[model samples]
Target: MALMTKLKHVDLLADGSLRYRRRIPLVAQEAVGKKVFQQRLQSKEGADLIKEYAEIESLYEQMVAQRLVRARKEALWGNTPRETFKAAKVSSESVWEGVRGLDRDDPEDRHLVAASLKDEGVKKLILNPNKTEPKPTLKDALKLYRKERVKDDAAMETRITRVWSEVEEAIGDLPLDELKRENARKVRDHMISVEKYGGGNRSAATVKRMLNVVKAVVSFGLVEFDLGDKTNPFIGLKVDDQGDREDTKRLPLPDDLTERLRASLRGDLAHIMTILDETGARVGEIVGLEGADLFLDHETPYIHIRPNTTRRLKTDSSNRMVPLTDAAQKSFKAALKEAETGGPIWPQYSRPRGSDSASAALMKNLRKLTKDRKFTIHSLRHRFKDRCRDVGMPKNIQDQLLGHSSVDVGERVYGSPEAKLRLAAQWIEKLT
Candidate 1:
């Protein structure tokens, strides 16, 4: 014979009979002394056992409800002394008279009366039944969501602040429930338009990212605040094609411009640009580097790119050791000499502001050498990749050197880190 499945909150006894087992609510337990509330049901069979369990469960709820009622009543009337009641201008007799007016036969009425007595706001609503509950505004919801969910996440917190700021500017503080698809579309249009919230016209990707944050905020509010039955207005929203712009596909700088930029750049900013040009590391990765991350003494000199308290790598693949070229070694050595006592290699830009600060400093000097807006600090990474491709380096080897995850499963899963380092070192040496 097949064994019967156990029901929730119902346990099987030693004799194979089901028992109704549930812990009483803490409030009820406190009001009425803690005692065994569980009982063995009469039925032993599956269907009959479930039926009996339901009936027992209902009785258990009623028992707890009665205890709660008593506790609330005591809190409201019995606990308050006559002197305290007089101070509040509330008479003991008047409170009892109001209680007596509530229908004793109706459980709902009793619950409402007890709830109103406990809460001043609820009591006011009870007295004036026509008064409506205030719905939380989008700004309120976003603030609560940030506190509960994204407070610890710097990137998420920044994105939420930016997205919500835009939404607030376009449409004033509206109720979260009142935000519909039409409002979302309007926000999207405003973001894409040249009318700056802060930055100039937002690209499609930016608009999409902002909308995604809005959706996440709405979704978080629904679940976090018990508003799941409500609709998420930001969901399934789309940005127009006109908003879409391709990512920067900057070409390698001409030899003269590159040389001029290298000569014009100075100090820590100069070293940062040199490192980017030589290693193809992201600006954030280079700026966030610590002294310990440099392994120049090792047989193969490399920089370990990893997450720190200040910032994180773009992806897991970004957490890798990049072997340094001759030019990169020189830059790294210069950077190490100026390293903080025990902190990051570039301490000047080590805090949360590192990446932006470093980029701005570098760009300011770079603009003097080259008029081309396309020749950004990031273009060095592109140039490195282009050089690797030009030299006939294997795609997997290129991916490893650049901290990009390989699309090929064989290379991703089976390729050894040592093998990758060897190939990458050889290819990077060729670029020098």
Candidate 2:
């Protein structure tokens, strides 16, 4: 009797050759254990009969070639039959062993190397597999960061780009995630020690700016990892005069100095500076004025201070009217006389012609006249607030004249039409 009972024929392709196979049933463990087994045959005649019908080892070379073409088509469309075959052979040494024995210079063998790595699960090997490397080529980082910020906030995006550029220049080959606090501190210290400015050594301000970049990236990383309540390493880090950086030094110039500075200035620069000193309007609002902003004919001459470039106002409160002083009214009248168009009242002080020309000819001219003075052109704005206080201008009226929103009274009840009229009237009376 034969214990070997042959089952249905199966087919397989090997090296562009096809061959048939047959299975003999056995217990699973024994099948796994045995390379070959002895079988008790029914008779010698039966054994011989089974061998005769087995077709020896017939190879279908043509069928195997056709199957290769079909498999290639499937692979191109992402079915990837070849990869599946390699994956299915993970436990089998002979399949990959044969792959290794191929010509070392062959491109196909290089692909086989990649497949080998994939088969071993290379993705599970890294500490921060999902996190991107800082060493991503400059081109790649730009594309990724740009794609991330679609809102086109130019100021914010510029800062991010600038910081990345600094980091890239400092460390060329290292990835961003590999950066440590020690290295970041080194960079900060280097910037503080080595960097130069218009003054002496680069101030703590410059150091703080560079550290801010490192902190931003780390914070972004922490958020990505869902880490809770992590403090940034850059937070407590300090350079020289660190406490002094917090002091904004916002105070008014003395009355005598303010008057001298005003008289020393000429043209739009003089007028603009004068108006800023009188009204406490921001430089942006003063420079961005249009003829329509001034209402000189009204009972109280006033100008609406809006925060806008070419498009629209920045905020609702920024759209309110501010009373103009006598000096401001005189400047506005002079600006109107010189205006070629009604768009911007102060036309001479319009947008820049060029970087060098604008800075040297325009800004430098003003700086030359005020060089001996203690006050900045911006200090005039501070003086306006101080003068308003000196003259016993009500806080609410002063805030209204400065086009500032009423924080004390709250928005709901402040800056009514009556309040605006009263403030504007008081401003006119004082100016007159």
Candidate 3:
């Protein structure tokens, strides 16, 4: 605001020329990286010099604003100027200012300018015009999602990775924002072209799971990048589940089959099946047990189902103690001899995809043992529930024993592991 003559911050030089000068705001001095802006004016003529002075002053105003915006962004998001633009975190005004200085003849600059002009939000994404990296693609989205969602379930990891890889291949790894509804449809159609999971052409259920993988990644990326929810191209996507008509529902193992399999199984599978049937624990939970997880010497013999290096529990509630049945105790004692003291009880099936490998092997045998497809290894878990419910066990206690979240949160989550184990032992002992 220093005015020597008629114009503000315009200094009349000793050599009879006009100079444009101004001190930067105190708060913004560090961000601007200078105490003041001083420029020797090129125009010495009457009205031209005044116009030149005005233009120089306006440019400095913009420079200060741009620098302050960058400082705020760095403070808030910890991103530098170039990273802010790349991440779509820069303001439109800042982007426009940065792009304004670029030479349009340069191919790189021309592309950025063209892209900004073409976009509805003008200059919004033109942060660093000199450095335009590839757009974030679907595969990138999946990689980021997997990194955040840590899971030791090797089977699911393998399955989901393949599902996303198939989508990426079908869609040529399209950028997340560039992914269209048609691209999702194409992926859905491509997945349904096979009959792998079930007999007779591909199932509608199969296509839905495939599409869900795409939806999950896209949704996760949109949120992670602070893109609006509606921007997720895969939202509201639908896949028809009207094909194949096959009964995929699992049925509880009949009492006769349960007894026969229990008696028939020997070695590790016998012990595993015993634990699965006796305590409604999932197969992954059973196979993940290290010798340390078993508390046989305690007053209430039990096994702790928890997250370990080899496997992650399905949910936080999955970490609990389940009292062992007499059959389960005997089986654990036998299985313990297979490992090195407190090491993994089932070493062969205790690593990534180990539980999956075990499941596939057990399922092959299970398929041979039963005529019905519904009576798979998982049916043993159902039989355990049926047995628990049949013996008049409280639904809350049943949910605790099964590692399932319950409607009665107090009953399911409000006890010491010992107290819970004692209660579980009392009810589970009632089971045959």
Candidate 4:
């Protein structure tokens, strides 16, 4: 029951008669004491009544302060009904009996849920009503992972291969559910550590890329096989590339150095690098380029790159004709002369059985050729971008040249073969 108190005071009338008044406390329990106190004050025992009333008010104030403290404590720490009484140590078990007695619509259900989580020794199990571990295998997860990649709008097959390779090396045998954060971190650390021994210190960015793939696979598992709510373990893992080995860094090659490298290179590698340099085409694009795609008509020769048709261009603007420079034109002429009927312009760039091993071989050769210029063959593409920037090419044209039109063009119009060829000629002049 609620408690209250009363105040007693006396007043003198104009006719010289004494009268009394009482103030009542707010609660029903205190109202009883207050009523009796007021009765005594009305009987003219004013001083005694006043003293009684003051005591009652003091008691009421104490009860109010204590009740407020209890309510505040209950609101903060009390989540479940059991926890509420447990914290408050309230003897009135009935207070928490009726759901309606407490605010049933209070938005503290999350806390109540957390408080009621099952403690399963070492591993606290929440919502494990079935009392069994979710049996999602890593192999199954990986299968789904690969299938999804195949259907990806962007077919990241190479990236998928790389991710699978690491998973195989580190925790391939483990189940998906068993591949927890600590194990993942250990594998990543091991990869970083042994990198120098295997070849050289691998870039953290490269390691992170591999980890991110694994992380993505885990996320897929969550959706494919409903794992209970847990924070994404890979979200906050730091992968710093700032201090990675100089040779491992993937920055653009200098324009002057690239030209020198092209001139110095002997056979197909040099020709391929030059093509990448002149056209700003990606390694994938260059590998897939063909003599049929190149047309030597209409005042200037142009290449018609189309996805799933002439060649897989990967973008609409990647189909652009980069008007061949003298160097590029001569290089292609020689390449065409050297090739079989169905062979590509730079046939060496084609997947020559086990593309991974071939790619690694190419990087090693590039490393030696650049005389520790310290970058992969892929950096030639980066050099192209840097060269474009250095020559003040518009961002749109630059993006087009790099085959990056994966979305709607913002303000900048997509270029045609003629426009691109013209742009390429200007860009080549800047390089020279």
RMSD for each of the candidates: 25.8, 32.8, 27.8, 34.4
Query: lDDT (0-100) at residue 369 of candidate 4?
Result: 59
Which 10 consecutive positions of candidate 1 have the poorest summed lDDT?
76-85
| Candidate 3 local distance difference test against the native | 0.69
Query: What TM-score should be assigned to candidate 1?
Result: 0.64
Candidate 2 local lDDT, 196-253, one digit each (tens): 3112344466567767766655555444434425554556776676433444343466
Candidate 4 per-residue lDDT, tens place, 42-132, comes to 2224444444443333343334433433433333222333333233333222323423433423436323533543432211222222234
Q: Judged by TM-score, which candidate is best?
A: 1
Candidate 3 accuracy as TM-score: 0.61
Preferred candidate (lDDT higher): 2 or 3: 3
Of the pair 1 and 4, which is ahead by lDDT?
Answer: 1
TM-score of each: 0.64, 0.52, 0.61, 0.56
Better of 1 and 3 by lDDT: 3
lDDT of 3 at 140: 61
Flag clash pairs in model 3. Answer: none
Task: List candidate 1 segments past 4 Å from native.
Answer: 1-133, 193-202, 240-249, 368-373
Q: List the residue pairs that clash in candidate 4.
A: 5-25, 138-176
